[model samples]
Target: MTESGVAAGFLTLVVVMGIGRFLYTPLLPLMLTEYGLRTEQAGFLASLNYVGYLAGAFAAGPLCHRFREFRVLVAGLLISCLTTAATGLSTDFVWVTAARLLAGIASALAFVAVSGLVLLIVARDGRENLTGLYYGGVGGGIVLTGLAALPTARIWGAGGTWILFGAVGATLSGVVLLLLQRHDEPRHSAATPRATLPWHPRFARLVIAYGLEGFGYIITGTFMVAAANATVGPTGAHLAWVVAGCAALPSAFLWSTAARRWGRLKPLVVAFFLQGAGIILPAALNGAAALFAGALLFGATFMGIVTLALSEGASYAPTARARIVGLMTGIYGIGQIVGPALAGYFSARTGTYHIAIFIASATVAAAGGLLIPDAFAHEQARERR
Candidate 1:
C-alpha cells in the first residue's frame, strides 16, 4: 500500500504537472512559429496560467480542509487533462488563455494535494527517502513532454500537438486513478500541536529568497525553449529542453543526499549559484552546446530548490507543514506571476531575452547569497542571546 500510494502520487504529478502544467514551455516556441502569437503575448498567456495557479493554491487550503485530499487530487487531475486538451480546440487567444489558466489551477490543486498526501504516507511508513522519487515526477514529465514534442511538432503542428499531449495526460491520469482507488485517503491519528514559529529574520529571509527563486527561474522556465530556437535551430531547442529534463530527473535525490551529507542550506546555496549560471549560459554564448548545458543546469536545480526550500520551511514550523508550504507556494507564485510577462515585454522591445535572463540570473544569485551559512549564523546567534 505504501509503495502503491507513493507511486500513484508520483505518476499523478507527472501527468498533471509535467504534461498539463509545463508542456507549455516547449510548446510556446511552436505557438510563436505555427500559431500567430508574439513573444510578449506568449508571456502574457504564461502569466495568466500562473495567476490561476495562485488561485488554485489559495483554494486548495480551504478545499483540503473541507474535503478529502484524494478527491481534490483526482478532481485536479481531471481538470488538468480536460483543460490541456481544450487548449488545442481553439486558436483564439482568449480561449487559449482561459484554458491555460484553468489548467494552472488544476495543476496547483493536484500538486498541493498529492504532495501532502505523499508526504503523509511516506512519513507514516518511515520511507522518507522515497519522497525524492515522488517529487522527481515533475522532471520525468518534463523529459517526456520535451522529447515527445520534437517528433510531435513536426507531424502534428501546434494544435495537434496540444491534443496529443492532452490524450497522453488523460491516459496517465486514468492509471493514477486506478492505482489510488483502494487507499485514496489515509487517516491521521491525532493532530500535532501547532507550533508558533514566529516570523524571525531567518524565516523572512527564506521567504524572500524563495520568492526571488520564483522570479528568477520562471524567466528561463517560460522562455528557455523559445530563446534556444532564436539562437540555435528548432531541433537544438528541443534537445536543450530534453537535456534539462534529463538533468532534472535525479536532481531532487542528489540534492537530498547532499543535504544529508553537507546540510540543507549549503547545498541549496550551491544549487542557486549553479542555477544562476545555468540561466545565463544560453544568452552568454550563442551555441547549441551552451544552451543545452544551461538547460541541464537549470533543470537540475529548479526542482531541487523547490524540494529543499519547502522542506526547510516545514522544518521551521513542523506542526503546520501545510500552512507553511501554502504560504511559501503563494509567495513563489507571485514571483512566477511577474516573471514571464516582464521577460516577454522586455524581449519584445529589445528583440532578445538576454536582458531578462541576466536580471533573472542576478536574482537567483542574490537568493543563493541569502542562504549562505553566515546569513543565518548571525540570526541564530541573536536568537540565543
Candidate 2:
C-alpha cells in the first residue's frame, strides 16, 4: 500500500502538472500559429496561469488542513482534467486564458496535497529516498507531451490536441484515484503545536534562491519550443522538447542519490550553475545542436532542484512540511508570473530573446552564488556542533 501510494503521487503529478500545466509549452507555438496570437499576448496568457497557480498555492495548506489532503487531491485532479479538456473548447483568447487559469489552480492544489501525503508516507516507511521517484512524474508527463504534441496537432489541430491531452489526463487521474483509494490521512492531536515558518537565515536563503530559480528557468521552459521552431523548424523543436523530457525523467532520482553522498547544498549549487549555462546555450548559439544540449541541461536540473529544495525545506519544519511547501511554491509562482511576461515583452519588441535569456541566465547564476554563503554557514555550524 505504501508503494501504491507513492505510485499514485507520481501518476497524479503526471496528470495535473505534466499534462495539465506544462502541456502549454509544447503547444504554445501551435497556439500562436492557429490563433494568430502575438508573443506578448502568449506570454501574458502564460502569466495568467501562474497567477492562478500562486493563488492556489497560497490556499493549499489551509485547504489541506481543513479538508484533509486526500479530499483536496481528488478535487484537484478532477478539476485539472476538466480544465485541460475545456481548453480545447474554444479558440477565443479569453476563453483559453480562463481555462489555463483554472488548470493552474487545480494543478497547484494537487501538487501541494500529493507532495505532503507522499512525503509523509515515505518518511514513515523510512523510504524518503523515493521522493525523487514521485517527482519523476513531471518529466514523464513532459515526455508524453513532447511525443504527442506534434503528431496530434498535425492530425487534430491545436484545439483538438488539447482535448486529447485532457482525455489522457482524465484516464491517468482515474488510475491515481484507484491507487490512492481510502488512503490514510495524517491526523494531528488537538494539543499538537501548529507548524510555523522558521526565520532561519538558511531557510530564507533557500526560499529566495528558489524564487530566483522560478524566475530564471521559466523563460527557457516557456519559450524553448518556440525558439527551436524559429531556428530549426518543427521537427527539431519537437525533438528538443523530447530530449529535455527524457533528461528530466531520471534527473530527480539521480540527483537525490548524489545528494545522499555529497549532501544537498553542493549538488544544488552545482545544478543551479549548470542550469544557468544551459539557459544561455540555445539563446547564444543558433543551431539544433545547441538547442538540444540546452534542453538536456535544463531538463536534468529543474526537477532535481525541486526535489532537493523541497526535501531540504521539509527538514526545516517536519511538522509543517505542507505549509513550507506551499509558501515556497507560492513565492516560486510569483517569479513564474513575472518571468514569461517580461521575456515576451523584450522578445517581441527586439525580435530576439537574447536580452531576456541573458538576464535569466544571470539570475540563476546569482541564485547559485547566494547559496554558497548558506553552505559555508552550515558547514561552520555543523563543525561547532
Highest TM-score model number: 2
TM-score of each: 0.93, 0.97
Task: Report lDDT per candidate.
Answer: 0.83, 0.89
> What are the C-alpha RMSDs, in order, of all predicted structures?
2.9, 1.7
Residue by residue across 17-63, what tens digits does model 2's lDDT show? 88998889889988998978999999998888999999999999888
lDDT of 1 by residue, 143-210 (tens): 99998876887898878888988889889888888877756464433363333654977778888899
Error of 1 at 142 (Å): 0.8
User: Against the hidden true structure, what lDDT does model 2 obtain?
Assistant: 0.89
In candidate 2 the C-alpha lDDT for residue 40 amounts to 99
